[model samples]
Target: MTYCVGMVLEKGLVLMSDTRTNSGVDNISVFRKMFTWQVPGERIITLMTAGNLATTQAVISQLEERTKEPDERDNILLKSPTMFQVATEIGRLMRGIISERQDANGVKGRGRFTASIIVAGQIKGMEPRLFMVYPEGNFIEASLDTPFFQIGETKYGRPIILRGYDRQMSLEDAAKLLMVSFDSTLKANLSVGLPLDLQVIERDTYEAGHQHRIGHDDSYFAAISDGWGDALKNAFHSLPDYSFYRPDD
Candidate 1:
């Protein structure tokens, strides 16, 4: 399992994903779940993937291959005129790969493979956009009402976002909020272990303003984890307790 989140903010986009995959308790491994492509000053794109690892890898590989081939069909890097189209192409690719794999293996319902992707970037002459692509090749754009999207092992980390998210928050605050969310998931879930990959894209720049791989020993993340826990405990204790409780009420 994995955890991935893509947030659309007034500043730009913030993406975070864990790097763990597990077949069983004894068989666990790490594989990067985030992929990025950039044309420097022209365009920058990032994708966070979750669900069937094989399907996601194949989709990414096919897209990469197309980008390398001059005569190949329009791939994620070339075919899409806007961030919207890029998301559509990625969704289509994901569905196509899953269908082909199922047919070849004859696994039917038992081996159904699926994946979800968060696509965010900007093309020259257009504004930055973020999209969440479903397994069926359909997607929705992030708007003011829904400014973020998450996939894979998401339930553990969603509440922080729901409670703290604000469209006008500074990128620094947004990144910190996401780290706290990740901290919550890491503490509660064994499947979502890290070295987390994070990228922050600033508006109109068409480049990643900050990108880093946070490992188990990362000091800043450690501080955030400890600080948040202490703060939460303090707040819980400070909340007014039930004063009129009755044993048989």
Candidate 2:
């Protein structure tokens, strides 16, 4: 399991994903789940995946292979005229791969090889867009009512995002918010581990504005983790005390 989040803000998009993939307690390993493709000044696309490692890796490998062969018309990441089309192409690819694997394995492969993806980026003339593609090949774009998406080990980090997200927030602030959320998830779940991948795309830049990997020794992340825990404790203590005794009743 892993945790990946993509947020849409006025300044641009912020994405982060954990690197842990575990089959069992002793079989744990790290694999990056975030992949990005950019056409310099033309467009930029980022995909963060979660679910079956094999399935996600297969999809990413195919995309990269296609990109390398310019003659391949299926290199939709670079050929798509619009961001929506790019997402549609990805959805189709994801669905095809999942279905093919499932059909080949019959009963044993049902949900075992399923995966989901969060695709975010900007196309030359369009506004930055974000989409969460489901395992079935369908997807929904982020809007005012839903400006972000989370997949895998989501329960632990979701509340923090819900309480703090703002559409107009700066990319820097967005990254900080994600760190706190990831930290909370890290503390509560063993499946999602360290060495997180982060990327920021400023609106209209058509390229990644910032990118970094947060390992266990990263001081900023360490501080965020520690500070958030203390802040939560202080906030809890500041709340008014509740009593079981009801004298008025």
- The lDDT leader among the candidates is 2
Candidate 1: C-alpha RMSD after superposition: 2.5
Error of 2 at 54 (Å): 1.4
Per-prediction TM-score:
0.92, 0.94
Scored against the true structure, residue 62 in model 1 reaches a CA lDDT of: 79
| Residue 167 accuracy (lDDT) in model 1 | 89
Global CA lDDT computed for model 2: 0.90
**Model 2: residue 163 alpha-carbon error in angstroms:** 0.5
Q: Report backbone clashes per prediction.
A: 0, 0
Q: Candidate 2: where are CA atoms >4 Å away?
A: 66-74, 108-110, 246-249
Given candidate 2, what's the lDDT at residue 202? 96
lDDT of each: 0.87, 0.90
Query: For residues 32-139, what per-residue lDDT tens digits would candidate 1 score against the true structure?
Result: 998888888888999999889899998888787755666765455655678877887888898888888888888675356878888988888898898988877789
- What is the Cα-based lDDT of residue 134 in candidate 1? 83
Task: Return the clash pairs for model 1, or none.
Answer: none
